[model samples]
Target: MNKLVTFIGNGNMALSIAKGLKNNYDIEVVGRNIEKLNKFEEELGVKVQKHLMDNFDISNKTIIFCVKPANVECVSERLEGKARVVFSVLAGTTIKKLRDNLNPEGVVRCMPNLAASVGESMTTLTGDEEYKKEAQELLGAIGPTRWLASEKELDIATALAGSGPAYLALIAEALADGAVKQGLKRDDAMAIMRGLFGGFGKLIQEIHPALLKDGVMSPGGTTAAGYGALEDGNVRSACIDAINKAYKKAVELS
Candidate 1:
C-alpha cells in the first residue's frame, strides 16, 4: 500500500509538494482555506479535506507541518503520538526543537525552496538514521534530496538553496532595470537578462573560473571593463554580506 502524505497547510510550499507527489503517492491536504483546498483538489485531482485547527487524524500517515515557524510547535503538539512520521519545513526550527515538540520516532526536518514547483529544487533532508532513507525517498519525489550527516547544515542549506532563489531573482531584476535605464524596452531588457543568466550557468558548467575569466578578459576588453566595474562597486562583498545576514537571521529564528 502507498503511504499517505498529509500536508497541514495550503500554502505555496505545501502546494508544490502536493503537486510533486500527487501522481506517485496518495497525497492529501488538510487546511483552513476551503477555496484553496477545492482549487488544489480540482487542479491536482487529489483528496483535499477541510481541517479544523484542533481536529485532524495523523495516525499511520506522514504528517507534514507546512505551517509558519511560529505555528509549527502548535501543530506538532496536536499531531503528537498520532503521526508515523512528522516532517517539518519550517525554517529556523531545528531537529532538536522538532524532536522536543513532536516526540515522534520518525521526525525529519527538510528545507525545500520555491524551485520545487519546477522539479529543480535543491532540498536538504536530515533526521534519525531509521527515517533517513524514507525521508529521502519522500522528498526526492519533489526534487533532488541531499541527506546531511549533520543537522546543523540545514541552516546553511536554508541560507543557500532556501533563500537563494529570491537573491537570484533580485539580481535578475536589477540587471533588467539597468538595461532598461540604458534605453532598452522593459520586455527586451528582461529577455536579454534572462539569456545572460542562462549563459552564466552554462559557462560555469563548461569551464573553471580561472580559465573562463582569462578567456573573457582578452587583455583589456569590454568584459574586463565590466569585471573592473563590478569589483570597484564591491559587489562580492555585498553578496557575502547578504548571505551572512540571512544565515544570522536563521540562527535567530532557531
Candidate 2:
C-alpha cells in the first residue's frame, strides 16, 4: 500500500492491530521510548519505522490511534501536525473529543477486542460519513466489522464485544477449574475446556444461545441438573449485572 499507517502507541492494542495489518500496509510505530518501540517490533516480528512522540510527524499519515482513554488528553498535547484520518480504539472516547483534541481531518471511533491479534475480533466502528466504508474495510483486514449509525450505539457494542473476551476467558478458566475439582487431571481439564469452547464457538454461529441450551438440557439429565445449579447460583443474573456495570462504566468514561 502507498499510504503509511502510523500507530500512535506501542501497547497491546497497537500491537494487535499492527499484527493484523502488517501484511497489507506499510507500518510505522510512534512511542515515547526507543526500547519499548524495539520490543514492539520484536513482538510483532515486523520491522516498522519508529518515531518518538516529540519528533513524530502525523501530517497526512493514517493513524491507528491506540492510547488509553485516560491518557488521551496528555498525549494529544504532545502530538503535532494534522492527521489525515484517525481510527481510534479508545473505548468510551467520542469522535467529538478526538476531533477537539487530536484535530484529525476525520476521526473514526472504534472498539476492537484483543482477538484482533488472532484475526477474529468483532470490531464496531462509527465515524465521519465519508470515511465509514474505508474504516470498515481497513478494520476488516483483521476481522469482520459492523458499522453503527451513532456513537451511542457504538458505546453499547463496546460494552458487549469489546469487553466480551475477558468475560469468556473467565468462564473458560472456571470450567476447567470445575473439572479439576471433580477429580479430573488439571492438564486434561484444560485441554477439554479449550476443545469445548472451540466447538461451541462454531456451533453458536448457527444456533441461538437459548435454543442451543434448551436442546442440550433434556429433562432430569446431567445437563438439566447442571443448568439448575447454574440457575440457582444466579449465573444469568451475574452475567446481566456484568453487562450493566460495564455499560455504566463506558457511559461514565464518556
Candidate 3:
C-alpha cells in the first residue's frame, strides 16, 4: 500500500511536490484557510483530506514541510501530534530545529527549487542517517536527489541547486534581451533563447564547462569576442560571489 504524505502548508512548494507525488500517495493538506486548502486540492488534481493547521493528527504520517522559515515556530506551535518523518523544504532550516519544534520521529532537510513543479528539481537531502535512503526515494519522485553528509553541506547545496533556477532565469532573460537589442524580433529572440538553453542543458551534462567554452571559441571568432566581454565584465567572479553570498545567508538563517 502507498503511504500517506501530508503537507503542512498549502503553498506553492507544497503544490509542486504534491503534483509530483499525487499519483503515488494519498495526499493530505493542512493550512490556516479552508478556501486555500480547497484551491490546493484543485491545483493538485486530486481530492485530499483537509484540516486546519491548528487541529490535525500527524502521527505515523510522512510530512512535507513547506512553511516559510520565519513561520516555522507558529506552525509548530499548532501541530498537536507527532510525525513519523518530515522532509522540510524550508531553506536554511535544520533537522535539529525541526525535531525540536515539530516532534517528528525523523527530520530530513530538503532543498528543492521551482522545477519541482515539473518533476525536474535537483533536490538535496540530509538528516538522520536511518532515513537517508527513504528520503532519497521519496524526493526522487519529484526530481533527482542527492544525499549530502551534513547539514553544513546541505546548506551549501541549498545555495546552489535550491537557488539555481532564479539565477539561470536571469541569464536566459539577459541573453534574449541581447538578441532583441541586435534587432531580432522579441518573439524570435525568446524562442531562440529557450532553444539555446534547452540544447545547452543536455550538452552540459556530458561536457565540462571549460571544455565547452574552449569548443565554442576560435582565437578571433565572434564567440571569443563575446567571451572576452563577459570576462571583462567580471561575470565569472560575480557568479562565484553569488554562491558565497547565498551560502552565507543560508548559514545565517539556520
lDDT of each: 0.80, 0.90, 0.90
TM-scores of the models, in the order given: 0.90, 0.96, 0.98
For model 1, residues 1-254, the per-residue Cα lDDT tens digits are 24777888878888888888877777778776678778767877666555654666677777777888898767765653466777888898887777677665578889999988987678998877788888888888788888887766888878888999998998899879977988999999988988988798779768997898888787668888878888999988988888888888999999
Show the colliding residue pairs in model 1.
none
lDDT of 2 by residue, 56-156 (tens): 66888888899889989998888889998999999899888999998989999989998898999999999998888888878988798999999989888
**Candidates ranked, most accurate by lDDT first:** 3, 2, 1
Ranked by TM-score, the better of candidates 2 and 3 is: 3
Per-residue CA lDDT of model 3 for 1-254, tens digit only, reads 23788899999999999998888888989999999999999888889999998757788888899999999999888888888889899998888888989988889899998889889999998988888888888889889999999999988898899888889999999989999999999999999999999899899989999999999999999999999999999999988898999999999999
Candidate 3 least-lDDT 10 residues:
1-10
Clashing pairs in 2: none
Q: Please report how far candidate 1 places residue 128 from its true position, in Å.
A: 1.3
Ranking by TM-score: 3, 2, 1
